[model samples]
Target: MTAKEPSVFRQGFKDGLPIGIGYFSVAFSFGIAAVSSGISWWQAVLISFTNLTSSGQFAGIGLIASFASYIEMALTEFVINMRYTLMGISLSQKLSPAFKMPFKLTLGHCNTDEIFAVAMSRQGEVSPAYMGGLSILPYVGWTGGTLAGAVLGNILPFSLSQALGIMIYGMFMAIIIPAARRERPVLFVVLTSVIISCIIYFVPAFSFITSGFSIIICAVAASALAAWLHPVEGEVADET
Candidate 1:
């Protein structure tokens, strides 16, 4: 690659490298979990590449392993990860208006939170191709770590494995930490989730709804409350 290309690529890599380091442990947990659930290493890796989402990947693996129907799988994942649709729209404005379908088809698969945050932070045009490279490396790394973890997990004791699994929750908590600091509504939503999760855990009758459904319900409810409490800025209607 050209020196200029490397310079152009450095920003996305810098943005994603920390995520890559974090994914080593977290994705390793996913890999081991996938293996423990009887999925193969290659399958786990493929899912990581295609899904590029932690919650959605876990849900898909659970449903796939459980022999969930296509409709069930689709609906569960769609509800859980519908945030990507909104995120995509927001990210699209960063791209040139001429961003074509082929580029979208190739790189759209890797539009995760880290990529979006990094891409949006840049002041000028972030070459989509360079961003794709930055995104792809971590994707492979996350999947690779998982595959390695799955293979190693087969030999490790259950206690050690569970301890290692805490990394995934820790990574999520890291995401929540920054958001909570920046946005009051985010903190409120998190608190709301905590309350709802307690209710879900304690209330026995509602157990029929899966984690996927719970996520959908909570997001919808939290969004409604956030909107009601904090209406869009400057949205007062002007009367003629």
Candidate 2:
């Protein structure tokens, strides 16, 4: 909170504020979804706080509601959230030399998509103070929004809750639609994934595999195909 300490921290907080505000709606949907999936309100809040992931947490809730075994849940989470590991590795190269392992470890826990993007967009090496400031607000917003939605879920009618459920997909579309419009490979990958997922869902033969495994299969297949078809150039990778 001390402005005299460093301008980078303040700048990071300022930049992160918008992402925090945006997180409210998404996390709100997640909260509603989690509660509807049979977890208690406090449990929903706890999941949001601890997991700090949108799609992964939603997928986990689905698995939990379906009574998936622990191994299945773990594997699904690992598959779905494996991108964070890549993000962390990419981010490590951008950190300031003064940023030690402890700082990296601390910041790693809160490095969600928005935070990573903002940090990577910076011109110079990322400072621990800035990352700290950047992460705090969004963390609060995501967790707070989940808490609010969980409380509201108890009072909201079934019809209204169902309507609110679409917000999660809407948020996803808002993210992918822009990039997919610009990038043919992204669009192709998305379509491929959707087709694969549909085939898995509708085909009786794939009925033995759970939805969780189906998603993993679709994602892996689509990503591998996309990588093969459109290997990213260094410049393109930087842009991405």
Candidate 3:
């Protein structure tokens, strides 16, 4: 409402563009992966529309590829995506009292690490609209990229496609490298997750799903334990 406040909202909009661009490349890869694995282009689009998460979508693709049962796919995604629950809780404290309900309800749907970091960095009576406004463009870009990639997958050269696929993971590493440097808890979570994942690969019964639920399980468990030990610091006003 204040002149100063609109500036923050505008900043969110501007920042969201680059963030959206980053996700588009990754989501585009998911689209190609889905289509190559036998899912139709429309189906790939729908998947991106319904689930914006890279992990969840990738897990679903694996389940679809292996012809896994619905129960298996649902359970895999549920356990992995449990991190969003914690993300929503943290974002709630940042919202203005009046905007709390709306933000709590909708933003949870779009709560990936990038957007979560954007929301958490704010300092005052942050508006939920700012969060929603920023997130929408990227969500569209991701979904659109997926559809485009699925349609274009076969037309591209094999080697080039392979390179592009690897690039997305490199982008992920770039995202991780920064946070892993400063956040001991995040570093621990990622490292522990990787170790557990290796165990899952080598172990028999635990290897039920290759959609990579190991990292999800480790992250949720580790983050839950961390949150319990170091309860999230509440809004600054609570301190005053």
Task: Give the number of the best model, judged by lDDT.
Answer: 2
Q: What's the distance in Å from true for residue 106, model 2? A: 1.3
- Local distance difference test values of all predictions, in order: 0.72, 0.80, 0.73
lDDT of 1 by residue, 1-240 (tens): 345666666666666776676666667778877977878988888888677777788888888889999998888888777767766876776675435788788787787766665665556555665676568667876877777877776676777767866765665676777877887877887888777866776799988877756765776677678778866454221111
Candidate 2 lDDT, tens digit per residue, 88-200?
87788787766898987787888887788778767767778889889888888889989988887557677765675565466457566777898999899999999999999
Superior candidate under lDDT, 1 versus 3:
3
Please report how far candidate 2 places residue 193 from its true position, in Å: 11
Tell me the spans in candidate 1 whose CA falls farther than 4 Å from its real position.
1-8, 93-99, 113-134, 155-160, 232-240
For candidate 3, what is the TM-score?
A: 0.74
Cα displacement (Å) at residue 139, model 1:
0.3
TM-score (C-alpha) between model 2 and the true structure: 0.69
Model 1, position 234, has a per-residue lDDT of 42
